[model samples]
Target: MVISNKALRFIIATFVICLPFISMANPEKDTTIVQTVVAHEGAEASHEAHAEPTDVKSKVKAFIKHHVLDSHEFSFFQDDETGVHYGFSLPIIIYDNGFQIFSSSKFEHGEAVAESNGNFYKINHHDGKIYKTDAAGTITEDEKSGHPTNVRPLDLSITKSVLSILIAAVLMFFIFTGLAKSYAKNNGIASGAGRIFEPVVLFIRDEIAIPNIGEKHYKKYMSYLLTIFFFILFLNIFGLMPFGINVTGNLTITFSLAILTFLITNLTANKNYWGHIFWMPGVPKPMRIVLAPIELLGVVIKPFSLMIRLYANIFAGHIVLMSIIGLMFIFKSWIGSSLSFGLSFALSILEILVAFLQAYIFTLLSALYFGMAVEEHHHEEAHH
Candidate 1:
């Protein structure tokens, strides 16, 4: 028997999303192998708190400096003996006025500084220690740490989430264009690849679009339903990739989608939907007034729920995966690595499922909105 294109596409989409996380399952080994080796050797060589060896190992020193230093100009590195982790070379401070420095190296060990004022300052640090050097070549003392820049976006900047959005867009274009061609060649007859996608498209058409918008009006809304369904599906799949950046992980994207739904729903809402929301014909005058504000709030809250649901689910998944991978470095043992591999594998599988589920939910909810907007109560009661 021939496998359905829908099933094949679903499987391929799942793989695309899960591949990145599966590949990232063993990040601990790549990140901390040197730290583990040094720890083992140090245990044999010295017993004192700070007596490991002052030939001055880079990793130990950099790690220490990062935790202990407190100035804005100075920083420390992790100091991998294998040189696998690159050291910092960029100036600690970048300014177009006289100079600028943006280091692209993976900084695990070393020290650097930028001097400004009488006191030495630390750059790139955790706790109180310095992590890298500044332009002036000075290290910071405790009680002198400068606040570092938090790279995470606070207000939906493009720099923060553009790549994720772009990835989603590109993936959507490829899949949908292929789908469109498949659809046309098959002459809407569901041949070849169209067979795979037809059911899903049909599902949206029959269950979502027709029921919600009513068959008479559903045709007008088909393009919007198709766009929302595929856009969400593409983003959901992209979120699952190992190297994946979560587009839906950001509230901004979700909020934007919600706003679009809100606009379309309200713009297209028939007389009955609004009447039911603001005034009930059977209800007492006093009761209608009391319910009006609550009903109005629901309109806003409905889209708000849409935004939060998608953002929270996607964000939580990414954070959980990152944290689990981070644990591998913290464990410092074979058991940790082994357990991480298994857990990561399982989670990757689950993420695949979540990708499809989220897409379905978004599409389903959107359809429901469209249905509410276009529903006609008088027409429904005519038979009765």
Candidate 2:
């Protein structure tokens, strides 16, 4: 299962090169485009049309936004003519007056209102938020702010992002457990999928954990470091897939991960770690007092940076890659379209590399923080 570097690169390159042609051959994409064109014309003829127009740039922007947002259902495709969506709906659990559980399909992809316990609810297409409404699904808006005045129930629905996280967690469990079994069965040697992931596991330990956190303390944090590295790695890879699962790109997800690191680092800090922060050994009393608050702020800033770094990189990458691919539709000419495709292909490969890089960076910084927290200082040894 362990692929050589050269072979991996070659496979990625081949896939990139073939992607455009493969997409061109897809009849569903072509059908969707044709339907969009037809729908656009129909909308132009009607004065009260509310459907999305088929302007090339507008459609592209809308598509990107849709992909970026979490949805109530998994939409693989849609037939405009038949007004049918090819997707499965997730359960919608809301607490307004009381608990109301229903299928997302009851909303009919946000085209219709769903009634539960004699209360009607409608999803706002612009923000993807569900709102309480009348039987007609009338969303009252304030004239001054132009914002909805409808009541919003507590939504505890399993959105696309939430579902993706559950999937990733389950996948990691099986993968690592299987790898452990392989090691035990093969006399401490990894077999099957373990062979592929064994090198990466070693890299994190040897290069990241041991170097940053000393060997004496690295083992204590190895489980956490390994878990986070692979967790982020798998989520990043999932975001790149065509399933539109952007778990890592979600700010909430990144923020949660950062919070975990923050809690672990501060909770496990040795006396020396806090001592240097609140009262430095080699510094003046006045300076120590001044630096204490700054060091405390650093604690919050570290995890904040971690959250933003992962979220921004992954989110921006998706936007840029999707925008480049969107250029193909905008450029109708062969030369322009070909150029767009070529740039997209290259960016796609780069995105795969970033998927791993972001995971590594997050893990490395975490290990470094752990190292700093547990580091011991000897005044006599330091003076010598």
Candidate 3:
């Protein structure tokens, strides 16, 4: 029977499954594994027909991990039964001992090892990393851990995640640039396309930037705040789609963004900022010395929290949402599947709110940090 379901079901399933395949090397032998779900009651199957998908348990875990991790290609969709992928292949570039560039299609959807420059390299399916091996393509296993033990190449391929980042960047460039030009044409007043973004830009300026940083210094830092706000918002919205673009969900991405905030905070800091950390003017010398270490440590802690907060929220949300949708396939029954799907639909809507919320939180906190950095201290008038 066809596995097709309702449009909502299809969307949830599609969202749950359209993960990228890094590439996996199977043995020369091909296994023909089939799963049959009998629809009607028969003489032989009079009691009940219970059919489970092939390797359900392991496949489920791999399915989730595949969606979460980065891959060398962009897989739009797939057919689980036939294992047919309907996505375009991306270019794969590796630097082992020398540079080797080839299309990921060379792997034939991980059915075969890719040969580049007379070098045989296979994909470690277990971890989604490429490994160098002999012509036989033997992947050694570590005794301590059942993981693959093979030398890896410097993989610098344009994967789905990387492509998504570029897409967001290009989109932002055209959008903001157009808005800026429209404002210029209208004699500093928002016009045409600028009307759409004008409210948000003003909100950030009036609500976020001005309130957080004083009016004098707010303009100087407006560019960074607006850029980050939209940059993260685009990524968070992109991730909600079935395309599997988890740019902000990655810790590396979040850490880099946090580092940017940290640098701007400390680098642009006025003397008052350092004075508070090193030696508070009003506080006694002994107390100032005692507080100095804690204040300095707080500087590091601020950015670290920023990194973990964005990463943890986005990453955890994806996992929870994916796991809920995955339960529908596992249930395979009308009632259970319906309940699982209902929950998924609710969470999906909530995720939309979260997408906007995360962007705001990041921007708000960043503006607050800017305020602290550029804040000026007042001293009492000289006493007689």
Candidate 4:
């Protein structure tokens, strides 16, 4: 009964979110207005570039690069004429001798410097990184290296990525808690929203968890697997939204997740697992020595592969999709513009599949690693 209530609430919340789009009496006219504004501004910016394909290509590349990277502030959309942003700005927190707290809006969408606590900082809009600069805000770059010669503080700002994580965490809490309550109320039978998650939970347990980690030990690791699976799955789905956060696509995020798996797999591993890593029991002494390094190297490679696989796939997808969409503006010709638009639409659909597939693969591999760690080599010991 409570589950049903929660489900209704969720539906209502979704409706509230959709109300704006639905309330629009003439979306076509609104779109036409926006497009008319965009074309007017874009033509002004690229008037000289209209004759030069190289100039257009450079502009497109820069635009796509900017789109894929993480940013301090969250921006849904911007107006070309008045330079108005249609999203909430994030808080900027930096530790430079003392704490500096300010809004990212202080930078005015990266066109200005933000000063707080007598310290001035500038966003390298070129790369979306923050750096400390003088009051005059001068960024000196070394001729040898393109990096700026400026001090950088420890930034603990709640960026779009951080906000997305917090959002996902809260969303999961509500969902799973409601699902749990519903399941409890039904006395083992799935009820309300539980019916939705029930199938996915069972699929993970049956096809991924139990099959990979064995029935006995699977339950022990289910918490970790489920947590990661849902967290990553939520992140993947969130990236598909126009929220300006590419959490999973960020290497730091994938790396952190991979490290967690690595630590859990190695730390919880049984004696048998280490025995296989350091020295193979059945193998000859000389062979074991040669194989030991390879086995150890494999440990590092496993997590590295996990990180790279997720980061590369998501990052590349975002880049390619955006680049193609950017090309629609560059290639004004009907044929080229249509081709780019079609490719972008097709890839957007593919990205949805990839979003789910990556979550599955990461969970599957983590479970496999867990199984290997807990597996007993009794038969091998007997043979030796």
TM-score against truth, every candidate: 0.60, 0.84, 0.81, 0.84
- Error (Å) of candidate 2 at residue 132 is 2.0
Candidate 1 achieves a global lDDT of: 0.62
| True-vs-predicted CA distance for residue 249, candidate 3, Å | 1.1
lDDT of each: 0.62, 0.88, 0.82, 0.84
What's the TM for model 3? 0.81
Q: How much is the lDDT of residue 21 in candidate 1?
A: 47
Model 3's C-alpha root-mean-square deviation from the true structure amounts to 10.8
Q: Which residue pairs show backbone clashes in model 4? A: none
CA error at residue 132 for candidate 3, angstroms: 2.6
Residues 265-305 of candidate 3: C-alpha lDDT, one tens digit per residue: 99999998998899877776798889999999999999999
Off by over 4 Å in 1: 1-160, 190-195, 379-384
Q: Is candidate 1 or candidate 3 better by TM-score?
A: 3
With a 3 Å backbone cut-off (N, CA, C), the pairs that clash in candidate 3 are none
lDDT comparing candidate 3 with the true structure = 0.82
Off by over 4 Å in 4: 1-56, 380-382
How does residue 11 of candidate 3 score in lDDT?
Answer: 88
Give per-residue CA lDDT, model 2, range 275-373, as digits (tens): 888887888679889999999899899999999999999999999999999989876556558879899999989999999999999999999999999
